[model samples]
Target: MAQEELKSINFMGWRKTIGAISILLLLVSIVSLAVNGLRLGLDFTGGTQIEVGFAEPANLGEIRTLLVEQGLENPTAVYFGSETEVLIRTQGAMQDGALVLIGNRLEALEPGAQIVRVERPAAGQAGLSQVIVLDGVSAAQVRDTDIFDRTYFGNVEFAQVEDGLAVTLENSLDVAYTNRLLTALSEHANTDVELRRSEFVGPQIGEELRDEGGLGMLVALFLVMLYIAFRFQYKFALGAVAALIHDVILVLGFFSLFQLDFDLTVLAAVLAVIGYSLNDTIVVFDRIRENFRLVRRGSPKEVVNFSLTQTLERTLITSLTTLLVLVMLFLFGGELINNFATALIVGVLVGTYSSIYVSANTLLALHIDREDLIPPPKEGEEQEELVP
Candidate 1:
């Protein structure tokens, strides 16, 4: 079967209107980012992450309320991989005396329930530095302990090495504090609740990550500009970079305007968007360069319109296929990646538009013509021998 040839659509005819809309959107996004900034997540704002597993499916609302009652500020509880597992995050680090206070409170609840600790190196893994022992707790009291802490513990085994239950500590957390929190949850729900893992991220570390992420994006853009300039012309490189910047700003603005959680994964998505938009813009630029050398009777605008029409089907098909996958991920990939998917979805849409209008318009604005893309004659070759 023969493929049908696509007709030229005069894409440049509405360049003025599209350019105005792009500028309007860019201004709005810049304003929103300046005024409403992104909502940083636990990954970028240092905090405590606690993962707990219940014998049955957990109630997120009830868990949040319990955490608040225990004086955890702005606790956020969401289901992890399963309904029975819940991950909780808070903005503050654990206090120095928090373990002692929790131990005292638990003593009031369960008299003679002693909290004991014995420290030792984790078996087989020299990298792990500590192990904690709970002297008086029963196996039933700590039911499914290994399963709950699987994320952090990896393959380390827990057993009754001595009279006490020996559980390896992935990080140096107070044993009493964990036991007390587990006991409180068990008592509240009348179910065996296990502390899967607890981790603390300091504010300083979060700040460093945030700064590094921004720096990384800037570096990527700079490198991209250099590559495009070397591959094509200076005008083409500038147009490609402009399109990329347009895509990035609009994506960031969407997140800020909606106050979405901007975390490490979303940052990754933004970078991926830059790559995606760049690829699309480069494809269009390649076509434009080819048309400039081949077509002899058109102005730069007409040449660009013809080039765009030639690649329109390819661009739309690629963007649509990519968007379909992103939409599915956004809807069904769960809470952990919802924001990541959303950032990409917006990026893909904005990137498609920018590649078509922003890059092409910039080329015409800069007065790009066949002369810019023409190669200089070799050192020994005569200028008259070169074909115009």
Candidate 2:
């Protein structure tokens, strides 16, 4: 049998240089986070998220500008699922009849644009169910319960039931809340708007979510450290934990430096990055431990190089294949998940680097000798008595 040939690349030979580069980038990221901070999305800051659709592609910048002109606070309009769909987010709770104002402004911007949907944080199993019929009645003529007061409907078919008007509403909301949004559109522009969805979330809930997200990440890291320590040597655990931390910091830095929307989704991605970095580090560390026992004569650095070389192809293939999918998602998965995909892409790239440089380098710095990984037999060991 022939040993597989490998590229004689000196990974450890450039350790100091890579370390310096990593440290510098981390410092820059910390500085950026302190100065620029992150752009928090509605999920973190507490606000309303309204999803609207147009008969054709509408201008996002124009919509944003128009919302601002209407005195909406810090309105952000971005493509939702497609160019024809836009999701608008506003900071703080919307003022009374704010939804109507938004619908009016949207109608003015693009006559075809309409408030197809609205979503707020759910309160509970609270809603309305009613049946109403009216003749020659405008939306405003309906009572508060007869309009867009429900986030969902069992049936809202106008074609199936015909006469003057027939509506059987289930789990509906107050007309003043979501219904007014619809009335504003139909009344002002005489445009038919569909009530897609609506809900409400308060700032206190956002704060709770923000705290929970941070706590979740901390718990994940602590658990990873404990698992690695029990599975291998303490030094191995330290190396793996350090690598995970390095990957996370780099990912967070990327977000902060770019001022990307750091929402709950991105926080989930960071936790995922920790898992990926730990997996890669564990793979290399396992090989190094095996080499310490089998190939008895080499310094820790030589063993580290050999282990990395053995696993290099596997690492590249896994990382590259995962990255390929993430690239596709970022390019074509639409605006709903672009940030999530972006976070994963950056994590895979940096996680691979940390597995190689950060984790292995920590083992070397810890002076991991053969005995640390593979214990020596006790001196003058006596054979155990056999039960005959």
Candidate 3:
């Protein structure tokens, strides 16, 4: 009765055409992945990150320019939380304390005091030159003026400048390159800035994260295939798995082709895509399995096509609603999650297409039939019952 009322759509009519397009798309995606690769974020590339807030709304371009001028290589500056906040990331100086700031000399002096150079012997066994020069003051007073006295050339000097008392300090290669940053900002913007957070990710840790992210995707695929195989026939499981792989690779192709930042959050979105696509595939597969038993008179192609037609409305509604939410996230979720939401947006669209065409096409190619889904009756059991 259900089969009689159902209207059949010819999904298989253009099977060859759809299959060719899908294959060509997949090939293009693969080529893009191989050629362009992905733009990895600092989470994957080792760097120093500093989150800071300004007294007023910040200008990212000015901040970036300030950092670049200060000898910070490849500095990336963006708004972190709000317009008033900025996050700066950079690969700092190669050597520790390489860049040193020398402040202007102090001109005003007391009546009894004179501005004089001092030489203080290198303290301790290092025998380094900790120099300070004074004409009248004791060694202690002269030691106080020894601005450039420390080892590795680390020190701070305060002197009168045209604007105000300018600060001179050394730059640390670590995330706390605060001295040079503070000096530069004070000289340029003259705004009060507060450090919110600072961190450094090492190269070894970044490599480990990249490796673990890859492993996580493989594990997710294996578990999903296992579950689907347990719930349905091997053929159905194979089709679903193939569809998932298609979705993942195609989404990854988008990332690689566009050079989107692929980070941990984006990796999480890919895993979510696998589950979401599998669910869609399962819905279609379940309907096909049911129709195979009830509409037993038709070929597998006709049955599969009818099954797809019946569920077409449900599939469209689900995909559309999900896409709406993803679009919102991509538009308003801020820079931190922009890549994450973009990955999901691309994945959902591709996942829907794969669920409808790739999975069903794979099943048709496998020649799925009623016999594949239904188990054979026990030998002679039906005959014995009929005799009885």
Question: How do the residues 84-180 of candidate 3 rate in per-residue lDDT, one tens digit apiece?
Answer: 8888777533222223221112222223333343233434514233332223333343345533333434653444433333333332223234654
Q: Tell me the lDDT of candidate 3.
A: 0.73
Question: How far out, in Å, is residue 241 in model 2?
Answer: 1.0
Top candidate, metric TM-score = 3
Which segments of candidate 2 are over 4 A away from where they belong?
1-7, 96-195, 376-388
Cα TM-score of candidate 2 = 0.73
Q: What is the C-alpha RMSD of each candidate to the true structure, in Å?
A: 10.0, 10.8, 9.5
Off by over 4 Å in 1: 1-7, 96-184, 187-190, 383-388
TM-score sort, best first:
3, 1, 2
List the candidate 3 regions with Cα displacement exceeding 4 Å: 1-6, 71-74, 91-153, 156-171, 379-383
Model 1, poorest ten-residue lDDT window? 146-155
Instruction: Order the candidate numbers by lDDT, best to worst.
Output: 1, 3, 2
lDDT of 1 by residue, 195-245 (tens): 888898888999999999999999999999999999999999899999989
Which residue pairs clash within candidate 3?
A: 117-133, 118-132, 118-133, 119-132, 119-133, 120-132
Q: Answer with 1 or 3, whichever has the higher lDDT.
A: 1
Model 2's number of clashes is: 7
How many clashes (backbone N, Cα, C below 3 Å) per candidate?
0, 7, 6
